[model samples]
Target: MEAVLPIEVEIPSMRVLAETELEEAEWAKQRCEQLNLIDEKRLTALCHGQCYQQRMARAFNARVRHREFKPGDLVLRKVLHITPDSRGKFAYKYDGPFVVKEVFSGGAIILSDMDGTENALPVNVDALKKYYP
Candidate 1:
């Protein structure tokens, strides 16, 4: 009786098969090392991005001037474009020399007309500038 090999082709030498397996193992090891390096690079990039954002924020904050309004101070309120009385190009940018009626902690202030009538809504300090006169 003749013995049958699993494969139809002539059998490869044991030394050749051993060499092929060793080459595959080395390639896999190198690939894993490369993946680790890529992960490290990604983390470094993330850290650099966060530091850049913080620097930009600090520079922006440094240039910003804080506006404060006290009760009884006169300020000019900015006119809204959505107002019914706005003219196309010649409209006045500021509406009033309104008096600050009440000061709120978080930069909100209640405005009053010259006649002592208080506004129903609170306005942000940014929308008003100190009246020189």
Candidate 2:
């Protein structure tokens, strides 16, 4: 005698279960692919951000031009706070009316006081509002 299914009913049910398993495997594979795609997108965005920052930095540096002062040039010096307590006080205020003794490449201007005391002061070109004749 040969083994046989019970009225051929079990065969159909087993086939259905196999089909379900195959579908689950396909779903898992698709999920993995989606995750990889997301990672790739994030990497691309990071690279673009870095490139943008570099471009902006280059443009900012280019827009600024370096200037220096020459000896015997009259320049005004802004008196900054000498000490922490001197802020917002009438004493130790900004003093200028000095003469330029030397200049550096990065807009640094050396000024000499009326008493012939010289000090190197870094000043922006834009900060100098007037030039004396």
Candidate 3:
């Protein structure tokens, strides 16, 4: 005996199964394409990141005015955390009108007190700003 439905009614399970198989095949194809493109995508992302970094560096360098210090130049050193001031948070941000005793090839300088007492440590030029007085 054969199962029968009304002429207007149709079994949807077969169509649904076929549609699901097609959908799965399409998904697998897309996944394979993505896997194949993964390396190229990573390289493109890396190139974009490097380009961004270079652009940022160029913009930064363009705005930067290089500071140069010579021996005998007077400058103020930024107060560091290692050297806490007695005044605490309200303390002055910079430490001296110290004299530049020695200039190094690298951006470092030796500082001296007004009395010409030289500091043993070398300070980065970034930490020192010129003292007008």
Candidate 4:
């Protein structure tokens, strides 16, 4: 039988190496100088950018105004995506041209058919499309 020599393995410690520590220190110094202080001009520019964004958002919202329908008002109800179990599956699609039964805030309108069947459907302000003559 031959004698077998066991091999010894060497492992390094998990601490940060010398070169990596030096590089990290240099990076920290550069970052500290870059963000030392904020000047008045920079602050003013940031504020101006924020204001411009807000104004643009407001203008976009104004273009799509919500139309609230009062009771007895004529409006068209949108056709919804129907499934097999839906009650309106056999009903007329886009069964609008109906009278408004009630009006709610945020542009929601309740409508009733000529046969007195009423549906209170909550819709977004943009969904309430106005039909112009």
> Better model by lDDT, 1 or 4?
1
Sorted by lDDT, highest first, which candidate order results?
1, 3, 2, 4
Clashing residue pairs in candidate 4 are: 77-96
Please give each candidate's TM-score.
Answer: 0.75, 0.50, 0.70, 0.50
Of 1 and 2, the candidate ahead on TM-score is 1
lDDT of 3 by residue, 1-133 (tens): 4444442122223344355465766655655665667777889999999999999999999999899998889999998774543676778889999999889898989999999888999999999999997
Residues 1-133, candidate 2: write the lDDT tens digits: 4344663233223344355565656655755676687789899999999999999999999998754566776766555447666645666443567777776776666667867997655565555533565
TM-score for candidate 4, residues paired by index:
0.50
Output the number of the lDDT-best candidate: 1
Where does the lowest 10-residue lDDT sum fall in candidate 4?
Answer: 7-16
Write down the TM-score for model 2: 0.50
Q: On residues 77-120, what C-alpha lDDT tens digit does candidate 1 reach at each position?
A: 99765667667678888989999999989889999998999999
Top TM-score model: 1
Each prediction's total of clashing residue pairs, residues at least 3 apart in sequence or on different chains, is: 0, 1, 0, 1
